[model samples]
Target: MTSPAEHPSAESPAPVRWGILATGDIAHSFARDLALVDGAVLHAVGSRSLPPARAFAEQYADEKASPVPYGSYAELLADGDVDVVYVATPHGRHTEDVLACFEAGKAVLCEKALTLDAPSARLLVDEARRRGLFFAEAMWMRTNPNIRRLRAMAADGACGTVTHVRADLGFVAPRDKARLWDPALGASALLDVGIYPLTFAYLILGRPVEVRAVATLSDLGVDLAGGATLRFDGGAIASISWTQTGWPDTRASVAGDGGRLELPSPFHHPQSFTYARNWEADEIAEPLIGAGYAHEIIEVGRCLREGLTESPLLPLDETVDILAIMDEIREQVGATTG
Candidate 1:
C-alpha cells in the first residue's frame, strides 16, 4: 500500500489515535488514508448499526491492532483511548453528531459545510471554543498540496489579477431512497456536491458580497441541478453549478487579467492544472501517495503535535462562513431544509 512521504530524521514520533464516527463509503475511504500515515492508528469505529462497525474495524486494523467497534456513536466518544473523531454522516446529521462529540470532550474533524445552516455551525464553533478542543470542517481539498500551490501562485499574481472563477462537480445517480437523492436526507446539489466547486472559489476569493442562485427542483422538491453566481468586493465573480441528474464536466477554471488556469478533472482532487498565458501553456501535477486524504490526516497530526486547536490553512471561521453562504443560496433558490 502507498504510504506518506517518509521523514527519515524524525525522532520520538507519536501515533494519532483515531475514532471514526461513521461506517459509510467516505468514512471507509478516510480510514484507508489514515492507515497509510505512519503515526496513525484506527482505535475505534462507530455506526448506527453494529455489523458494519465490526466489518470496518476488521478491514482497516492491523493483525495485532485490535480496534473496537461501537454500535452507537456515544460509546465511541466515551472511549478514553480515542484522541480524535472524524464525523462522516450526512450533512444534516453533522450538527447533532458534532455537538455530541464536543460534549464528550473529544477533538473533532467534521465533514464540510460544517452544519445545515449558519446558526447550527455557530453552535459547534462555540462549543469547541468553550471546551478548548480542536475542531475543523473536513474541507479536504483545501489541505491538498497541489491546491495549496495553485492558491499560492494565484496570490503571487501568477494567475494575474484574478477576475473570474468557474467550476462544477456532478455525478449521475438514481433517485432512490439513497441519501444523495432523498430530501429527508438533506440531499441537494449544493450541499451534497456543489460545495466542492463553491469551496474552490471561497478558498481562492473569500466570501462574496452578493449571491444569486436558481435550480430545477426534483419530484421530492430538492434541487436536481442548479447554478449559482457570487459577486465579490473587487469586481471578481465566481460561477458554480452542480447536479445529480447529469454527469458534470468535473472541471474548474480561473481567469485573470493576464492568464487562466484550468483543471481537467475534479477540482477537488485534481491531477493536473494547466497554466496558460499569452497563448503558451504548461501543466503541473501532484500525484497522491494513497488516496488524497493522507495529506489531511498528516495535517491533523501535525496540528495536534504542535498544540494547535485549529489549522490556519483550513480555519474554523472559514467553515462557518461557507455554511452561511450555503444557507443563503438555499434560501434564495427556494430549497428549504424542512
Candidate 2:
C-alpha cells in the first residue's frame, strides 16, 4: 500500500488553472461547477475533434475567461497555462488518459474507478508519484460535505461498532449509449454504479476480510448488475448492490447496536443524511455548493496550491484498494471490465 501524505501544506499566489480532458456529461458538470470554486479557472478543454471542443468552450464561456478549445488531448496537455487536469474520459481510457496528464507534468483528477483494474490504477499512481505530481480519483461522493461529516460520525462512534452497512445505486441505463453497454469501453455495472455503494461501505468500515458476490451479466459479458456481501472483522458486514436495469431505493445506511445513519435516495450525492439515535431519527442538512461537483474541484485546487501529491479525503491507496476489491467481485460473478 502507498503512504498517504506526500507533501507539506502551503499557499500559492496564483489560482490553479484547469484543463478538461474530455467533453462528456461529467465534464460539462465539472466545468459548470468550476465556477463555484473561489480560485479555480476553466483554462481549456480538449476533444478528439475541434467542433465539440469549440462548442464546449463557448457553452462554459462565463465559467472563466472563455476556456481555450483544443482539437486534440495532447494540445490541452501541452498548454503551458494548464496547472491541473480533470480527466473525464471513459473507464477503458482512464489509464491512458491519466498517464498523459502525468507525463505532461500536470496534476490530475481522474474520474472514478480510476482505471479498468487495480493494477492499472497502481500504474497511474506510481507514475504520478514518480513525477511528484498531484493525483486523485475523482470519486466526488467522497468529497461531498455531508458525506464527509457522515464518515466522521462513523469514526467518532456515531454508529456504534457499525455491524451492518447497506447501500444500493441503480438506474435504467439506455442500451443506445455505447459507453454504458460496451465491454471494450470498460462498461461494467460494478465499475459504474457498484463502486458507489462499495466505496460507501469502505468509507465506514475499513477493508473487509472477505467479499462474496453474484452478478447479472449482459449478453456482451459485461455486468449489468450485481450484489455483494463483505465480511469484516468482529462479524461486521456490508451489503451493497448496483444495477443498470431497474429502479432501486438508491439509499444507504450504516447500522450497529447503538444507532444508524441513513442517506436519502440517490445516496451517492444525497441532499442530506438522517441520524437515528435512541429510537429517534434526525435529519442533518449540509447544502451542496453547486451541483455537488464543486467540492472535489475545490479540493483539487487546494491540494495543488498546498503542494500535495495525494488528497487525504480520497487517498490514492484507498482508491486502488477499492478497485482491487471490485476486481475480486467482478471475477466471482464472471464479469469482465473490458
Candidate 3:
C-alpha cells in the first residue's frame, strides 16, 4: 500500500490532470476536495453553456493551478491534456457521458448509482474493462479511513457472527427540485439517496439472494420514499430505507450473536462508530481526515499510477451488483425512470 503522501514523488511525475464533465453543485464539492489532494489537478470543467463553467472555474481557481472552462462537454472530452474525467452529470445522463469519456480514452470516476438501470451500468463497466481504463463508482463513503477500519473489524470477526444490518438515509428535498421530481432526469429516492444504505449492506453482507421492496411515488411517477429488505445466502439480512420527502434518523447498525456496531448519524461519511463485544464496554473507533472525497480521489490516482483498471476497494463487479439491486427495487415499487 503506497502512503497517500508518497504520491507525486520528488521526481515530479505530472499530476493526474482531471476534467470535470458537469458544473453542478456536486461537481463543485468534488473540485474543492480535489484541491486537497497532492497528486490530482482540476484541469478543466465543462457544461452545456460556457457561463456556468467559467463561474465554476473562477470559484475554484488557485494561483498555482487554474482550470480551463469548456463551453461543451464534447470539447472537454477532446482535450488531450486531461488524463481522467469525473462524470458528475445527472443520473439520466450518466450512461452517455461515461461512454463518451471512455471512447475518448479517459479514465473515469463516475458518481454513485452509476446509471439509471442495470443494463446501462453493465455496459459502462464492461466497456471500461474491455478498454483497460480506470473506472469506479464515486461512492466516497467506501474510501473513508474510518469506514475502512470498520470493514476490517467485521472481517476479523470482531462482531462475531454477523446476523443483521439496518441502515437509513433521508432528507427533505424541496418539492420543486427538478432532479428529485423529474422522471426524465432519473429522479427517484432510491437512486439519489438510498444507494448509500444499499452499498453499506452489500459491503457487509455481499450480494443478497432475495430482495423485497415497496415505495411511495410522487405526482411525476418517481419514488419519493422507499424501503427494502434483503436476504443473503449466508443467512444474513439487511433492512434499508430512504426518502426525499422527509428527514429520517440517518443512522446505521450491524448486529451479530456477540454484539453490535453503531454508526452515527449521516452514516455514509461517519468519522467514528461504536463497537461493542458481548458484555464488554463499548469502544469508539475514530479515524479522522479531510472531507471524505479526498480518500476516493487519492485511490483513483493510486490505481491510475499503478496501471490498474479498477479499484480493489470498490470494484466494478460490486458496483454492477449494487445497481442490479436498485433495479429490482425500482420494478417492485413501480417507479418509472422514463
- Which candidate leads the pack in TM-score? 2
Q: Which candidate number has the best lDDT?
A: 2
Task: Tell me the whole-model lDDT of each prediction, alpha carbons only.
Answer: 0.82, 0.88, 0.87
How does each model score on TM-score?
0.93, 0.96, 0.94
Model 2 worst lDDT window (10 residues)? 1-10
TM-score (C-alpha, index-matched) for candidate 1? 0.93
Error of 1 at 69 (Å): 1.4
Clashes of 3: 0
Report the candidate with higher lDDT, 2 versus 3: 2
Write one digit per residue (lDDT tens) for candidate 3, span 227-334: 999999879999999999888999998888878888999899988888977677565656554678888998998887777778998888888888888988998888
Candidate 1 Cα lDDT to native:
0.82
Runs in model 1 deviating more than 4 A are: 1-12, 63-65
Candidate 2's residue-wise lDDT over 1-338, tens digit each? Answer: 11223222344445677899999998998988997787888889999999999999999888345799999999998887887889999889998889887777778899987999999999998998887888999999999999999989988999788999999999999878898998989999889899999999999988999999998998889999899999998899999999999999999999988899999998999789999989698999888998899999888877776667789987999999999999999889889667
In model 1, what lDDT does residue 168 have?
94
- lDDT (Cα) of model 2: 0.88
* Better candidate number, 1 or 2, judged by lDDT: 2
User: Lowest-scoring 10 consecutive residues by lDDT in candidate 1?
Assistant: 1-10
Q: Candidate 3 regions off by >4 Å?
A: 1-12, 279-286
Q: Give the alpha carbon lDDT tens digit for every residue of 1-338 in model 1.
A: 00122211135454777899998878988988887887778889999888999988889878535689999898998987787889998887998899888777788888776777788888889888887778888888988878887888888898789999999999886656477777777877788788898899997899999999988887777877889999998999999999888887889988899898887777888766899999899998877657688888888878776667788977888888888888888888788564
